[model samples]
Target: MVARERERGFERFITFVDAIVAIAITLLVLPLVELTAELDDYGSVSGLLRENQAEIWAFLLSFAVIARLWFVQHDAVEHVVAHDKRVERLLLLWALTIVFLPFPTSLVAEAPEEPATKLLYIGSMVLSTMLLTHIDLLLVRHPELTDGNGDADPVDGAANVAMLVLALLITLLVPATHYFPLLLLLAADPVARAWHRLRGGGSRSAREGD
Candidate 1:
């Protein structure tokens, strides 16, 4: 019963954190209000927009990408409904990345080409991926938390962590290499689903991309 209460508390906290993350992305666009200076002419306004073109695109891309990552994490945890130390720590790490993302998004929007901003972006992604893989590990190793047959070769958890580490290391290339490994998130889902099917676990709604 105590564990159940803690799990409820954790879910409540996660809901709060998710709401804050949603608001932060919305705020990213709010800063662009400065783009409209004292210019009255339409052509002059267009020029101002052109001058800030890169910032706009960078913000939009980061916003969309972060939204995607957040959704994936949410789905990973949705049916989990637990709060043991392992799950708690993983959720906290996920929350940390969600909270940390806005600052880097703002920095990139202001200076997308700057190395610090780019590295920060990569680091945030790496942290997020690590936490997600941690979730997978918890579910895999602790049969109490899952169907007990969804994961095999727990090495999958290790591979997920290694993939994120490689991507993080490649951040030396800054913004250019930052998103290269993000595709792995989607790819892992199919691979994991296939493994579960082979193991006779069948496809869960979450893994089916619902």
Candidate 2:
């Protein structure tokens, strides 16, 4: 009976996390939706697009960021058969970052040139990514919380966190860069794979051969 209850609790926790992520992603579009109200000011739909390109870009970027974060979180917990208080608290804090993302996203759209806005937007991302990294590390430390599917590789999360920190630093040092540094995140996966190989953690086939 206790096992059954724990299973149900895990299911409920996962469902709640999914719901929160969905809501946060949906909120990213609300600002764009409100743009429709100013249709008259722009004179035409194309004009509106031209004038509000920054807002549109910000929405798209954040949507992608949140989606990627959700995927990372999902992968981290895919093998989790149970949860503990620490995991629960970390997940809630991660969710809080997701929910707060839209606020800084809006700020970026309104003041793209402000260092403070850049800090707020990218800083939120750093915090979220850091939380995931911590969770992955926690799972590595406490294998009992997960099924014996496979070992967790926290290198990916750590690599991402590093890339984001680099991006944040670039933005701060070069204010004119204007979010371009974020492109560095695209290299995170490759960097992680390289690091893993360097650590003698090769592909499954290589390990099997060994």
Candidate 3:
């Protein structure tokens, strides 16, 4: 009975997290909606889209990022059989970062040309990723928190942290290269795998979470 109740409680927590993530994802598109009001002013719809291409790209980029973050969070939760209060707190913190994303996302949409706005948007993503990494670390350190359903992979966390750190450095060192840091995010997994191989430890299946 106790085990069943614990699982039920964990399910509720996961549901709540999912709801928050869904809301956050929905919020990501809100900034783009305002662009519709000014559509006729651009002479044509296509022209308006073209004129606001930066915002469009920002929206798409942020959407993709948030979607990926949600995936990571959902995947992590699936491994959890029972929850610790610390893990719950970390999950809430992670959700807070996810919710905060839209604010920076809007800043990017409003001032896509500004270095500060771009940095802020990327910085927000980096923070979100870091929080997720911390959660993964906690899981790894406290395997008792999970139900043996999945193995926690810390390499994944390391790769993400490395990627974001490098991205931040590039943004700082090369302000002219707008949005280039985003490319690192896409490369994170491959880079992480290679890192594991070079280290001569950790099986491929394990590194890839297979």
Candidate 4:
């Protein structure tokens, strides 16, 4: 009972953290000036949206990507048991990054045409990936956090590594790609997830036979 209570407390804390991330994601959609009554031009408003289509696309894309990343992070953390101060300390960094990510997401949308802006955006993603790597390293260092002693899903580990590589490659294109490659990630996600699931099932079946 006491153990469950302690878990409840920690789970509540994580929930709060997740809430902050959601709000941060929502906050990225801003500075949309309303069309005034004097400027009752629907055409003008539509034209404005069209002119800033890249920014709008960036906003939507970043929102989706960031939300997906947060969902993954939350799922990973839920299954993980920090085991020691080192692992616990890394969660603090993770939360910090969660808060900081919005700045880059918002910036990317606002300046999609500018190369520097894209670089800044991709830099944030790279930092997120690095932090994600550090989290995985912690999990590796403390194998107790995983089921079947971290060897159960070597394929999943490989998929994550591949995804990290893909992200790093995409990052290189940055503002020069003008969010083209970033948009392409939308297509890659489903395919990668499906491949990962297939590999996981294969690993499980092999383990069962053993």
For all predicted structures, in order, the TM-scores are: 0.69, 0.92, 0.88, 0.66
- Cα lDDT tens digits, model 2, 1-210, are 132233668879989999999999999999999999999999999999999999999999999999999988887877777858898899999999999999999998999878888888999999998998898889889978877664566778888899999999998899889899999998888888777678877632234334
Model 3 misses residue 173 by how many Å?
Answer: 1.5
Better of 2 and 3 by lDDT: 2
Best-first order by lDDT: 2, 3, 1, 4
Q: Could you give candidate 1's per-residue lDDT for residues 78-145 as a string of tens digits?
A: 55655567776777778778777778877876666576766787678767766776786667667565
TM-score sort, best first: 2, 3, 1, 4
Q: What would the per-residue lDDT of candidate 4 be over residues 64-142, giving only the tens digit for each residue?
A: 7677668556545655533445645665676676677667666765655565655566656555555555666566566
Better of 1 and 2 by TM-score: 2
Of the candidates shown, which would achieve the greatest lDDT relative to the real structure?
2
Q: CA lDDT of 118 in candidate 4? A: 55
Steric clash pairs (candidate 1): none
Alpha-carbon local distance difference test for all models: 0.64, 0.86, 0.76, 0.57
Candidate 3 deviant stretches above 4 angstroms: 1-6, 113-115, 203-210
TM-score quality measure for candidate 1? 0.69
State each candidate's clash count.
Answer: 0, 0, 0, 0
**Candidate 3 per-residue lDDT over residues 20-71, each given as its tens digit:** 9889888777767887898779989889888887778777887888898898
